[model samples]
Target: MASGEERYQEFAPPPALRPFVRTIWTYAAPDPSRTIQRIAPDGCPELVFDLGAPYAEQGEDGVFRLQPPALFAGQMTRPLVMHPTGPTELVAVRFEPDGARDFLGFPLSAATDRRLDMVERLAGFAPPPGDPAGQVAAFVAWLEDQRRRTVWWIDPVVRAEITAAETEAPAPTPASARAASAQRALQRRFADRVGVSPRLLRSIFRFRRVFDHAAHPGEDVEGWLEAGLQAGYFDQPQMARDFRRFLGCTATDWARDQHALARAIASQARVAS
Candidate 1:
């Protein structure tokens, strides 16, 4: 088995593509253990091109379905559980929160929690044939071509909401009447473009910060009370609630269990930034 560091790598997008593409990443696990991996939600959609043995995702019914070689993974509100079928190699594009809509030319809400075959969803799309690096280059070129042919526009309100959700500013107060009204208007457009409501996106963003805090050098569960506060949680219980909601476990339990593979991928992959 490759070490976590060797198993994953992330590459930045070109300047012109940065606004739409968050990052391109590759993961290879040639001899993975028979352990199920739980991937937490991060409010971004992905285009995955599997180059080696496929992985199987567990559906809500608890049945596992083999993933397609090339597929679009839409925004997920709950954790996704998957186990390897054999050796695995994947090169994937992580799109910005609202970027997939412009590329897919459909309402992202239609894709939430769904993985659509890329070739079926996007005409003429296919998994680029090459090694990981060459595949990434080919995919980026394809994306650039698509950008030129497509007329793309992002809603300003959604942009502002994403910015506010990702900020480290103090937990926001209750919304004002006018702000609430504006949020209602934004929710429809946000859901159409981003696959989740603005409030849900904010919750997911805040939930991700808990991991960031726990990852800091010398931080541990002993200090999670403070970590939770810094992560915009009102208290440890509030943080624990979110941890349970998103991870299906308490923070302490999650730490004790040591989900190494999931942690490694989450730490290395810049899904939304």
Candidate 2:
């Protein structure tokens, strides 16, 4: 089996697609030793094209079922546990936080935490036929066509809220009687476009930051408590709460668990960035 870094690769989207597309990535591991991996939420939706054996995802009821060969994964609120049934080869597009709706032509909230058959749900959309690189090229061309046909727009207030959440800024305080109305409007716009409320997005971002700290500790960092503080948590207990809610495990337990594929992809992404 190839090493994780060698098995996975990421490519940049074209300049024209940068506003909507975060990245296009490929993963190929024909004989992986570690099969199961827990993938935590990252606030972005994805379009996945499986060129090799399909993966199986574990449901809340603990049953594992095969995933569709081509699928659109919506904004996820919880971790997704999955394992490849055979050889694994995939090409995927990761969209910006509020980008998927423009292409799908529906409110994003409808697909939250769900994976839909791409060709079935998306009229006139099909995976390009070719090797991974050729398929990516074809896919990019298709996206360019879609871009030309669609009118692109994002609510300014929702855009600002996404920025604030990513930066871990404190929630804004209502200044007047109309503030409540304005806040509701923001929430509606955000949910329709981004598939989650601003507060939940903020929490997810903070949780991911803390997880990153755990995955790659600095030389001066002492422990998880310090990591939590660095990640904007009030204390260790608060961090623990977030870990339980997002990962279904305590920080210590999660650290002890080996999620080889997930960890490797995350490390590669950090390096690429």
Candidate 3:
């Protein structure tokens, strides 16, 4: 993170593209440090175009390499650590849950945990401009043509299964024999379209829900227990395990840390809650 105030802004795309694009954001970290940003899953995929200094993605092997200027990151089940070398500016699009599959012209499951270049994936497309606003216009032009020719390949059963899974929370998952068959079909189709198991998606949502609780004006054992329960965890132990699993940090440690992601999540979660 930059010591100096950073400029972070977000804008909606053209109305015609609203269904696919969640938002396009621009971040200008003019006075960047070697800040390590920890990214967690929010059940959405993204396309980020770097317009400033390049950043690196820390590998599982403890190595860090500069990320591609333009990359398509799929449904992330684990955390990603990013390190910026200097001043950094980013133009990024956070896609709607099912949006990336259609816009990217490929099943999302194939892209999980991978960083890819748009030019390599799609022909006749070049790297973007130096400005965020300009890049967006260029992207829109590319997408307009794609929208007319590309056909969405999602399976009907996969859609229904996901719908059921998303809605099943306050309710129980299906138990009937027919429902079991549907579940199996859903799993196969979903894996085809989204690339992750329904069970994994559920876990992502569960872990992310705790971000809101970090903003809750509570603390200690009692607050942790309540927060875990609210986030759909059966108990503190489960939530604690998840914090370690995805973030590699304990729940309490994360709460006490000074990170932009956690702070922003807390702020947004408060408003949403």
Candidate 4:
């Protein structure tokens, strides 16, 4: 089996493309003859565009399978969504919470099936012959066009209207001084539109955010524990409980898994690029 780093190396996105989107990546079959099994974990909502011939996706239940036509984006809760062992290439977009909200016409708090027909239409596109640069240019144009449409379709217009109706709608106060202001914005925005308060979102967000630090490979968990305290977790026990609840593992296990994957991706990315 290929390590996560191996998989990442095979599919790392071009460095030049990172600024345009959050971690856009492409994964291709590792060997021309062998199939690659992809296990996608529960994560931020994402869009996947197929660049090769269409392929099969095993449903969550595993009893059913389907061929995804070209472009699709939705909530992914399982580990193995696409088990493509054949020749295939994909472009994946992982959106930020607010960006996801603006892009999907829904909140990131829920798993949804959002299919943009235009994406598939564009995926069916054929890049000009002979120039790899031309093909990528064409694909980038289609991607930007869809991104513009998605942003236009959804913004906090409805939420803004509701906030306007309530006379006391607290003017977007800065979140508590104890918590990072950005964290507070994530909490408030999620609560207003997603129906869950930021406190709840923080439990999940913090669990994930620790990864930002933990991915460093040598950072001690003690520092993370202390950071959690600063981030407003009542205590280490409280933080650990939340990790088990949302991430399905203890902090140590979660950090290790992500670290492993990060290492794998970083190493493989060099070769893939």
* Model 4 misplaced regions, further than 4 Å: 1-23, 27-44, 51-89, 101-139, 147-171, 174-197, 214-221, 254-273
For all candidates in order, the CA lDDT equals 0.76, 0.75, 0.68, 0.46
Model 3 C-alpha lDDT per residue in residues 1-273, reported as the tens digit of each score: 435666555667787777677677667666765657666677678887776668888898989998877788888877788777777777777776667787776678888877777635445544354455766676677666777777644455555555554554432345354477777876666666776887787787778777556654446778778767976789878888887777777666656663543345445534644
Better of 1 and 4 by lDDT: 1
After TM-score superposition, what is the CA distance of residue 42 in candidate 4 from its true location, in Å? 9.4
- Candidate 1: worst-modelled 10 consecutive residues by lDDT: 169-178
> What pairs collide in candidate 4?
5-264, 5-265, 9-268, 9-269, 35-85, 36-85, 39-79, 40-79
Regions of candidate 1 where Cα sits further than 4 Å from its true position:
1-5, 121-131, 169-174, 177-181, 213-219, 256-261, 269-273
Q: Model 4 over residues 1-273: C-alpha lDDT tens digits? A: 242222332222344333234455555443433332333222344555565545555564665354564543543322333344445455556543334554445555554433333354554576553333454566566666666665433235434422332222433433454468666665556543433443343344444444344334555768878777765567888877755555445556544554223334333432332
Q: Estimate each model's TM-score.
A: 0.86, 0.86, 0.80, 0.52
Candidate 4 TM-score versus the reference: 0.52
Clashes of 2: 0
- For candidate 1, the lDDT comes to 0.76
Q: What is candidate 2's TM-score against the reference?
A: 0.86
**CA displacement after TM-score superposition, residue 41 of candidate 1 (Å):** 0.7
Total backbone clashes of candidate 4, pairs 3 or more residues apart or in separate chains: 8
lDDT of predicted model 4: 0.46
